[model samples]
Target chain A: MQNGYYIGVDLGGTKICTALVNEEGKVFKEVTVPTEAEKGELKIVENINNTIKEVLGDVKIEEVLAIGVGSPGPLDVKNGLIVETPNLPFKNFNIVKAIKDVYNTEVFLDNDANAATLGEFVFGAGMLTTNMVYVTASTGVGGGAILNGRIFRGSTSNAVEIGHTTVNIHGRRCGCGNRGCVEGISSGTAIAKTANEAVKSNVPTSLKNYDVVTSKEVFIEAAKGDRVAKEILDEALSYLGILFANLANSYDPDMIVLGGGVSNGGDIVFEKIAEEMNRRALKPIREHCKIEKAKLGGRAGVLGAAALAITELEHKNKKDGYIIYN
Target chain B: MQNGYYIGVDLGGTKICTALVNEEGKVFKEVTVPTEAEKGELKIVENINNTIKEVLGDVKIEEVLAIGVGSPGPLDVKNGLIVETPNLPFKNFNIVKAIKDVYNTEVFLDNDANAATLGEFVFGAGMLTTNMVYVTASTGVGGGAILNGRIFRGSTSNAVEIGHTTVNIHGRRCGCGNRGCVEGISSGTAIAKTANEAVKSNVPTSLKNYDVVTSKEVFIEAAKGDRVAKEILDEALSYLGILFANLANSYDPDMIVLGGGVSNGGDIVFEKIAEEMNRRALKPIREHCKIEKAKLGGRAGVLGAAALAITELEHKNKKDGYIIYN
Candidate 1:
């Protein structure tokens, strides 16, 4: 029963979710844990390892082929290391080897968004598509590309930092220490930050002064024709339009699958983004693409990691039931 | 000599240059003429046709395999038609068919910049590389991408519009109907425009009295330490650095080839650009890339078109003389 199991670990700052999936993309079991990241790198690694063990409690170690871990970057995918990631205290950590040591199997490591893209490609939106782009617009914007059905890591693994491409020269300052990044304008934090400032500025709107207002509330209020909310919504949509247009210009993908908490705003954001991208994007480009929300939701991270392992399994299957390459 | 004659034309707004290249990436003969848009599209077409005829003068028609025309877009590359390029005037014309009718051979058409990138791949800096980016900082900030050694055109002809990607959200307005585009910040026009404004704002530079100071003059003055010029240089370099970093994150090219007039500024621009890109680009990305100047000059245009054709020939040879689908 456990002969072909694979593991997926979603390593987040506040929570960790690990899943045991089969080659058919079905989750057999999952374990979720609170990640006390402030407790430092060793603690988080221990937490991640425990989550994997719990997910595999009923399965034999020999049954698992490999474990896939998805977390924030900057990561060295080639050497399976996390090099100075900001959220976690780990500096130049070889997380892949450590996980392999425990699981006694090979491990695959990738940036969280990239892993999610792999997840979507297999069990989610990108199924059967030859070329696609998956962009996550949550705390910060990030992207991953699938070209000819293979993960496209730019020459330096520096590919797909879509959030940092400048949308406005004189736009807001981003946490990345740069200005006008897509994340600076479209992420959940940015939206909430905008909402808070407008409420404080005494802008005429239905939104009142609240201690904190998330991007979710802004979309909810804007739907009710709250003037302040619309203004904020328009700003976000405009930035999104430009960013989408730029993405279209850069990667001629067949589809762009949007994910993250903000995408949950639905048509409130989609319509405007479509209009602007169409208006600005030109020739063989304008309507040659379709923009859609990512079909997989909260499970994208965990499932995506599973998808990675499943893909590895398929590749191995092609070579007489052995992993293609280490 | 007649066995392998091919025509390549690089059409500019002010003039048109046509070359008849042999199979060895060498120009056997060429002709150049003025393109008077004011006189209208017909005249320009006539001039273009004459240049083609002149280049062919007495050469055996059967020797030519195909003709490649590189002009400013928007155009219909598939049908060999010119839609309505920006710099060139023609409400919407078909230059490809026009040449095909006169020359009686197959024809190929692409955006001039894209044509130049293909040229670079076959005959210039991108010669041996697969994943690469070509940015021409001349009249406008034009970009072309060679992914796996083939020109990557988006769904529409508008793919690879690097200049339109904003480096400054609130900076200058762009002609593509956007604001603060990469072109508006880093193009030759942008540099000269910024220098013009700096001079007008009384930034205390030695250039205050010049009727007009170009990007070249600005670079020279900046090299000589004029404060206004230096400040403008730094600003231009910063914008370019961010632009380059974003492209790196998106494309993950092994190399970025810089061209155009400003690129000729060489080390002054390169040093600052490399520093900023290295500083801003995320990890695992900066490791496997190199930034180099385009070795081909004005010759890149015609040569690129010629290279485009020659590569096909070499590919045919590699595949045992079977023509591959382009």
Candidate 2:
């Protein structure tokens, strides 16, 4: 009997990352390609299929037990459908069914953030703990909660949307129509928007030098001792600190792992966030939870999907007549 | 095989409520007595012992499987000790060991909020759904979460502290040293405080007639078409609505059951909160979740503790050669 392998795919607005991994979660083969999401749903689905096939390459087809896809959401995870994604031009697309039809194999789909959380939990920063909250501060702030080593999918499989949980009431206008959400104030997009607005206001800062101020440039300026840039970044980080503190008090997780673009600010960002979290969170959480940076970088998405596939594979084995090959 | 019974104790600052219940969650007997907590820890422990004995009167000792207690927290659940309670004069008191020594049977302990959530989940408003959030709006807002029909204790067994989660960034000073927590704006005490502050400001209202305005008087005045009363109550209810909406987004529970003193404000409060929640929450949550008043009244605490005992009994049966009778 051959030990089974898994295919993990991370589908994004601009790119699709896929990999082939064994039960041990070691990636021995990988592939990446542009998603070209603007081309429409069919093209995107076809691209996903092609990416998986490319990753499979010369491997024995029957040896691959399942495939896991981490896609941008809102999604219908239970039914394996992409409900509607802001970045991707897909609405109610049955990506899982399409892939299953071509490969005739098992498929699992979850929100990209949740998948990355699992990746971090199974193979990266969260390896030391069973319960962890993974926060991604990318173009948008996204969150995933792993409770008891399993993703905490609430009634609608959309729970743990920590980014949207209100940190400031009636403070800022969020895209989702909420006022003062973490996403509205602390996301990379939010930081870039703040910096751009400051430029438009003719703020006395070196940031005016950039044609378009990115969150990265703002961090660089802040690092170079720019007062205005420091103020904007500090405000954003403070809101994040408050958000994390609130999460710690509510969820009381073992560890909080921070990831994404903004987190690349390195030790300064991590230490500042930890101090703010400790100062503001409830007494118990301040003493108990460890705040840390996510260790898995580019591979978190695919690895997380692979981990999900492993979980699903085990569930399937217990339900069906299948047996695990060790 | 003989069927088992459970004894549950609800320990409060002022009273101790104890009950005996069968496996099906039907309460057969109960005993209530003053805690006289200020008399000190020894007297409080003796009072708890007496309450248990009174509830156990005329019962066959061999049929009782375990005893469960729901006490005021922030306490150590795993070790069965009260960390420190503001109302009760106890510091690191080993209440569980004391009870266990008396009964010599399996004993379980949890915070009152967690127990009440279980009570609601097992036999009250939460009986209809597997995943429910129980929010108590008494002296302070307390919350408990039941996921897949089990209590969701976080990594440190201190999860679901919903009241402490911030809603307004700088709106109100919470007792926990946070700004704008649900407990600071929406609890029964919070409502009363707001009403009193309005009175102190010399607002022309019927509330001035009372020597001390309570949350109930505020509700009564609101019902009588008092503008200030209505405004105060509306503001409190709105904050609660924001909180519930945030919780719905965070936990995505099938239902949110409201209990305790403030929740007793009836349909006006319930309908107003429901309307505000629907107005603010995401589309899917607005469509899926049912907001309802808690059914179990005075019995919530004792029943919740009883439910904890049942869960512990089952866990014990699965582990250490203990058998459960059908």
Candidate 3:
């Protein structure tokens, strides 16, 4: 395998973080810049290019292999186009072409969660197992799957719309206009909303003292033995476990890696999840998979992007040419 | 594309039925015999061999292009051996070798549900789609997945276990030692148990007329608009809908083919399922996919077995005289 430097960019709604990663996933250089997305598509393009240049910083750009970008969906990942994204200002943006304009090299593109899964598969907790699922519990429970050691993007780019998996047929109304999705029931936003409602409903909760109760505040209070906080935590954990059990029952993954802000609850969350999953999931698999905290922290997204860059390059080399056919 | 004669053997626990099928999946001659499984494994082997001979009595032996067998599981389909099956008396039965011994020809084997799906995929309602799911709603929800035009047996050859999918965490117990499996809530056997309990629990409504209540009796009363019957039917439908919706959401198959005796509820059941799936599934796919009645009916298992025989032969031919490893 050829070991070379490549650029990995995390294209967020408000900012862009670009890094120069060697083949071994070591970040030699990195930097960030404001996306200024509202200024129009041109500004976002210029910003990504600028961050890329800064990350490269005369580190023999001629030797660098490819550039990878992880963005929100539903994206046109095949064409490297951002299609109808909710968070970013651009729609149907030819991101790969734009990055090519700046770097004049090979480029890799995929959904943020997908890139993150590849990152985990090759370099994180998922490194030990091939069949696995990684879910990022941010605003919503975005997910990506590695089935049989490959990212399983269905015939379309939208295969693992896992957050949309119907955990409850008649549960809470999800943002996707469905009910009882993992995201709808136990997202960070959902947990905060539940806490707020309980406080307003005079549920004798410690969360009433917060300016606005969030998932973080609830976890902190729950650790202190507050009844309302404990109840809310229990509710969220059970729903998350059910969601994991669903994934386990269907795909029979060897491991499920949890990421994002909500996972900060640590052992309290992990123990409950394992217990509930063992109770709900089919035997052996429920006991088979070891659900633990993610080894990659906040930098998981960036590291995943780098892994995507290397994997795409390696796959291209395997086919004896850089055939970018989707 | 080649059309020829094929032998299909329904290797059941109690009976062995063998039929001769032309390229059109039309049976020209058929024969049946008691399995006599209690006579031990050798007698059962003799029963199968005699059934094949009787089915093709007048025809030349060389006229048979392929031999296929459909039997219960869990089985090592790849190795042509039956594993520990709950419905059968034999353990670790080397079915392929046994059949090959009598005929001195190629014999193919598959689990019953897998065979059923292949039958539907090639010659039934699923003919239009390369990807589909066939679920048999009998004692338990035995199912098979046709993914990308091939039957998908996961790492263990025991995938597509539709009955065990957990629909509710705090719901009924399942036979597979899991909580709230789709089978526990909606299988014919599970439904009959629920119907019996409701009638005995003395819910103030109709359906006490039958001394022994069953899933069939419940359906008969529900068709007439009885309140208790309606309630039981509704519960069963809701759970079934959830199971179907989850499969739809997860796999995004183009069609779902329903088989087994319970599917005789037919339009009444499908109409209710359509209503719930449309209201519950993720957007777009919510309206996507046609849930249709399976066309292969009683002979599905045999035809599927034949299809598998042909497929296995073709797959073997693809690797230049080398068998492709799964």
On TM-score, the candidate that comes out on top is: 2
True contacts kept of 3: 0.31
Where's the lowest-lDDT run of ten residues in candidate 2 chain A? Answer: A317-326
Instruction: Judge candidate 3 at residue A37 and give its lDDT.
Output: 76
Sort the predicted structures by TM-score, highest score first. Answer: 2, 3, 1
Per-model TM values vs. the true structure = 0.78, 0.93, 0.89
The residue-level lDDT of candidate 1 at A244 comes to 80
Question: For model 1, what is the C-alpha lDDT against the true structure?
Answer: 0.78
Clashes of 3: 0
Which DockQ values do the candidates obtain, in the order shown? 0.43, 0.65, 0.40
For candidate 3 chain B, the 10 contiguous residues with the lowest summed lDDT are B317-326
Per-residue lDDT tens digits of candidate 3, residues B79-150?
A: 778876665677888888888878966688888888888888876888878668888887888788876566
TM match of model 1 to true structure: 0.78
Judging by DockQ against the true structure, name the best candidate.
2
TM-score, model 3, chain B versus true chain B: 0.94
Q: Give the count of colliding residue pairs in each prediction.
A: 21, 0, 0
- Give the alpha carbon lDDT tens digit for every residue of A1-326 in model 1: 12588899988778999999886678889988988889988888889999988988879868898788888877777777788766688788888877876778767877888889988888887887766788888888888887656667666666788887766656688897766677898888899889988888856766674456899889988898888888888988778777787787777677788899888997977898887776566546657767888987989989888776666556555652222323
Sort the predicted structures by lDDT, highest score first: 2, 1, 3
Q: Docking category for candidate 2?
A: medium
Share of reference contacts found in each model: 0.68, 0.65, 0.31
